[model samples]
Target: MKIPILIVMLLLLTSATSKKMWKTRYFTKHVVQQQDTWCVHACMEMSFGIPQCMALHRWLEYSQQLIFPTLNCCDLITPDNYCNCVEHGGVARSEISSFLRQQFSPISGVFTDLWDFLPRGDIVQLAFLSVRYTSTYHLVVLREVEQVEDYLWDILYCDPEVGYSTRVYNPNKLEIIY
Candidate 1:
């Protein structure tokens, strides 16, 4: 009887130890708010885990090529320039900000299982099919979260202007995979 009881207790202990450890996670607080069409910049920051300003500056480098081949990082983010390209793929106030808000086609937020990729500590760039809570024509980053049951996990994310939504992602509702 003692041997059986010992075995049962040890088994229970081992089962608990073997269970997967779960945790909740999210992006940095430096997420840029949706201001002056800064959704893309904010998304970039969330995706890259950098400051909003740095994301904007880096985007200046990435989009500069698309807007104008001759433009450089410094040319777009200078004190006077600030990516104020009113023409081309760019827009005023900040070229990166305006272009992100297509205001038409291309949609907002990608229809993806953001939760699927969050566990790996990956930051994915997403364009939503609809306005995700408070953002429009913006980019956002989905952070990885570890939970014992995915059903209980509300994916943590930051819109251009806000950080972390209260709502959670339901796989059943989001059937469109793309």
Candidate 2:
């Protein structure tokens, strides 16, 4: 009898702790979607996070609906020899980046690849030895733009799966790089 009671208590405590952890993980101050553009609205109203990033596909769908009311979002993703909605390779990256920039002004830079689409290193200092190549690629908010350092912004994206909870660098710990 006592063993069963103890087990039940342990389970209850574990569940309570897990719930608290989840709450903190998914916590966002606000979330909003524009009538036509979801990504822009999300970035403008809410702080960028993994949850928002994960919803990229969905936002794409929503945007497609607004752009082409007749077609669905899947239609856009589907491959096409002609100029359908599907865009592959480097072209897709550039198109997506351009589309994002057109909708959002807060985004100062963007970096896209055949596989991953992200922001440029205008805000974050990356690994050495390249005037063009950037190691860390993702959107960053420009806090200051110095002539010497160029541009300064807090790191917004780290790992998409883990989600970006805070800035990549802390002024106290890291030095600013141009």
Candidate 3:
């Protein structure tokens, strides 16, 4: 009888704990989609700790409603031809921005100069990187930005093409949904 009462008390206490707690998690270890045009998909998976297949499924559903009703998102997507690959290209900034807002209302958009973004801690922003050789775009997750009032600064991010590179760029309407 006493054991049952004690177990009940413990469960109550655990349920009463604070609900507001933030923890930094690395999803790369669990799953990684090291491919082209899937940067947005990868970032989505990382932020939410979901699998690439699920993300791809959502993309297919969305694309069907918006772009092509006939094409299926689940149909085999190989490196040669992905839903948002070189053949089909990628989704637009508005599509990603709106999708994230609806999916994760906790997310907030910041469309400002990197210099002005005074980040207090590690922040994740969905960014688009222009391909140097061709008229195309790739997805990237803007992870961190460090600056000493313009004298010295650098930005870090992860992408399939670069893996993780630190370079300077004027984000072309960055869909920074944190």
Candidate 4:
């Protein structure tokens, strides 16, 4: 009886010690948008763990070869020049997808029910209508999703415009993008 009890306690202790604890993992450094129209670029930087200038340069290089062959990074130093280069005011989603595919392996897809499918520690892009400007759209990187309770969840994200990572309680306003 004593031997059996000792073995049972040892097994329980071993199992408890071997069990892994859940942890919230996200990007430690937040990358902020360098320019007004560079929100997507900043999000990309945060996702790729690259610097702001490098992200901008990579985008410029990709854009020059495909969208505007004549545009150069130095030419967009001034606000007017940058605005002229980006005639649409912001980068398009298709452009972002194409760039990601070309530079890295195609690793994203559109998912409407993100909360159910999103994996922990994976970075994703989200699009939603701007709170301040209802007619405009904004983008951010979803860093982590934590379940607070049975039906509630906490969303951790990096907002390029805000220049930091923020946690919100069950944000239902945003749409997840690849």
Which candidate has the top score in lDDT?
4
**Against the true structure, candidate 1 has what lDDT?**
0.42
* Candidate 3 residue runs with Cα over 4 Å from true position: 1-35, 66-75, 78-89, 119-134, 149-151, 165-178
Global lDDT of each model?
0.42, 0.32, 0.50, 0.57
Worst lDDT run of 10 residues, candidate 4, spans 124-133
List clashing residue pairs in candidate 3. Answer: none
Best-matching candidate per TM-score:
4
lDDT of 1 by residue, 1-178 (tens): 9999999999989765742322223344545443455555555555445544554454554565443346443345434554543122222333433444342122232344534334432333333322334433444444333343434444444445556643454443221111
**Candidate 2 error regions (>4 Å):** 1-66, 70-92, 108-159, 164-178
Better of 2 and 4 by TM-score: 4
Sort order, TM-score high to low: 4, 3, 1, 2
Arrange candidates by lDDT, highest first: which order? 4, 3, 1, 2
Clashing residue pairs, candidate 2? 110-120, 111-119, 119-138
Stretches off by above 4 angstroms in model 4 are 1-28, 53-89, 119-133, 171-173
81, model 2: CA deviation in Å? 22
Model 4 lDDT tens row, 1-178: 9999999999989765742222223244677677777776676666667655556666766766655556455456575554543543365555765665565443344434545444522343332212224655567776656565544567767788988877777746446655
Residues 49-133, candidate 3: write the lDDT tens digits: 6555556556655665564445444455655664453344345655766655655544554344443443423443333332333
